[model samples]
Target: MQILEIFGIAVALSIDAMVVALCWGAVQPTIKASHILKFSLVFAAFQALMPTLGWFAGGALYSLISAWDHWVAFLLLFFVAVSMIREAFEKGDDNEECECRSMGSDIAWGKLSMLAVATSLDALAVGFSFAMVKTPIAMPAIVIGVVCAILTALSMLAARVLSEKAARHSKKLSLLGAAVLLLIGLRILFEHGVFA
Candidate 1:
């Protein structure tokens, strides 16, 4: 894939991480630099690693599923996007304290690892696609990981900066997140000939 295309795909895959980080930023008293770095590292590392793993696994199964690869991609992305949109719409109390360590659990490393893996599931599937398409997974995976790291950190920063004025606009942010997801879902469907 071309660089721009890879970047686009990376962005699409990173949206979930970005949104979660935004939520984390909003709930925290003050977003710390360390928090951003932690999220970026966990997210980026997982994003990078999952695709290579998927590529290897997918390499084995690619022959059996070559024709359905695009469809699988479309389904995975579409579902992920839709779920994000749905989560964004759910009303919730924002009174919970935000710790840089864990979302709702103790065990910092374990929680962080789980969060990273949870957020990077899409990349796992994309890795599978790389195998199916014979795309060089290393470059694209690196690109995805780096971009997600930057974007997640930036999003946390942005949400922290905006939290003061953004208190009233939380729902709007969620809606915007949802819209981005829907658009990505549509793009995937269109790309896969779901509309044709």
Candidate 2:
């Protein structure tokens, strides 16, 4: 039962990453197998690390801001989502020809870590919640990390294949990704009484 509960939460959490991966694939249709592998590893490492970090932080900091963590998570997710929306609408054809291969291969560790940390900020709050619920720490964190890694890689691959066959659909894909982020952000806000 606990495993199932954790799995459900992990899936819910990974929806954002999976959607982002799809958009990444759509924007850069020339993604390679190596790119998939590299991104999956990067995403997985971060997803896995975030909850554990959050759990530790929770132990040390939850008492300091117990009432505000949810609001903070909501704000962080909203900010990130808003950024995605803004980027989606940006008119920078300068990057249309940019190859995913070069970028993936040359990904600086610092940037990768930054992206990982940025995307996984909500997981930190989720980790804090895990402490509140008294859930065992290690298993859920591992599950969420592994599941996100696999889902993100699969989404990227599917997006690449679809984009190759239907190049014109890239805009639609971006819109869909934006919608996912918006929904996730709104959901977070709603949970936090921001909408109430």
Candidate 3:
């Protein structure tokens, strides 16, 4: 594939990660640089690795991967979103100073890992496409990884800015973020014809 085509695909694949990062930013009352960098690196690793895996697996396992990847993503995202929303309404949440359900604004490995996998699912499919086309995977994978990392970080930064401005409105913003995540999950399901 041409460089531009590869770049386009990379951007398309990275949208999920970017959105997820934004969700984190919206839900997090405080933005930590360490968390952002760690999240970005983990996401980048997943994005880069999936395509390579798919490329190597080639067409052999494409169908199996494709059949369930979207559902997996939808499930993970939906679960997290619901958890965020539920936590928002939990008892003893009236303490505005409390970073309740905040996950310490630290890196929660479980959710973060799940987010990385969920966001990188599309890139796995893309890797399969690259394999089918016999296109070189190294360059494309690198581009996809780098682009995803950068976009996710940028999105998080934007969210941090918004977070700073809306610190007092963290509850409202968290609810909004959770709602958006739920929508994103449903969108993934709908896109995969899960409820069709």
Candidate 4:
């Protein structure tokens, strides 16, 4: 895959992390630099790691599925896209109020780890898709991690100013990410001559 395409995938995969970071930023009574660093590092690490794991798993299965790898990749991306769209429409969590009330200034390592893993699940699938399409995982993984870290950090830092607006329009942002993944999936199909 081209660099631009990899970058697109990276951005698409970072949406969940970005949204969660924004929420945390908005709700926390005080956010230290340490918190931001810790959150960004954890998110980035998971986002990068999951895809690498997926790539390895996909590699193991590649020979058996080689004949129809393109289809598998497209389907995986489609599933992820659909899931994101579904999540976008789900009602806001009632627990958010409680979270905001309870969240203090310090970082919670356990919760951060869980959030990181949760957000990176989509990236794992993307890595599998990359393996199906025979794309190199190194650049994509690095780009994905870096982009996620930057976006997460920015979202957290900007929450003070944009939190309310971001919260209101988060669904739109999610839909946009899903659209990007859908388009990327279609492009993969086209490249494989599936659309020819």
Steric collisions counted per model: 0, 0, 0, 0
Better of 1 and 3 by TM-score: 1
lDDT of 1 by residue, 50-110 (tens): 8899889988887788788666555655565566566555634443333434463222667
User: For residues 17-72, could you state the per-residue lDDT of candidate 2 as single tens digits?
Assistant: 66556656766637788767776787777787777887787667657766776665
| Candidate 3 wrongly placed segments (more than 4 Å) | 59-104, 161-196
lDDT at residue 69 of model 3 (Cα atoms): 59
Per-model TM-score, in order, reads: 0.69, 0.59, 0.60, 0.93
Pitting candidate 1 against candidate 4, the one with the higher lDDT is 4
Question: For each candidate, what is the lDDT?
Answer: 0.70, 0.62, 0.68, 0.85
lDDT of 4 by residue, 1-196 (tens): 8888888888888888887777778877777898789988999999999999999999999999999999999999999999889988883742322134344566579878987998899988989998999988998899999999999999889877777677677778888889988998999899889878
Name model 2 segments beyond 4 Å from true. Answer: 61-107, 161-196
Q: Residue 2 in candidate 4 has what lDDT?
A: 86
Q: How does model 3 fare in lDDT?
A: 0.68
Q: Write the per-residue lDDT of candidate 3 for residues 1-196, one digit (tens) a residue.
A: 5786577666656655765676567777777788779888999989999988877776565466665656655565565556556645652244343232454567678878887998677566557656645567899989988998898788788874643343444445446656655565566567668798
Off by over 4 Å in 1: 67-107, 163-196
Candidate 2 global CA lDDT score: 0.62
> Which candidate number would show the highest TM-score if scored against the true structure?
4
Positional deviation of residue 26's Cα in model 1 after best superposition, in angstroms: 2.1
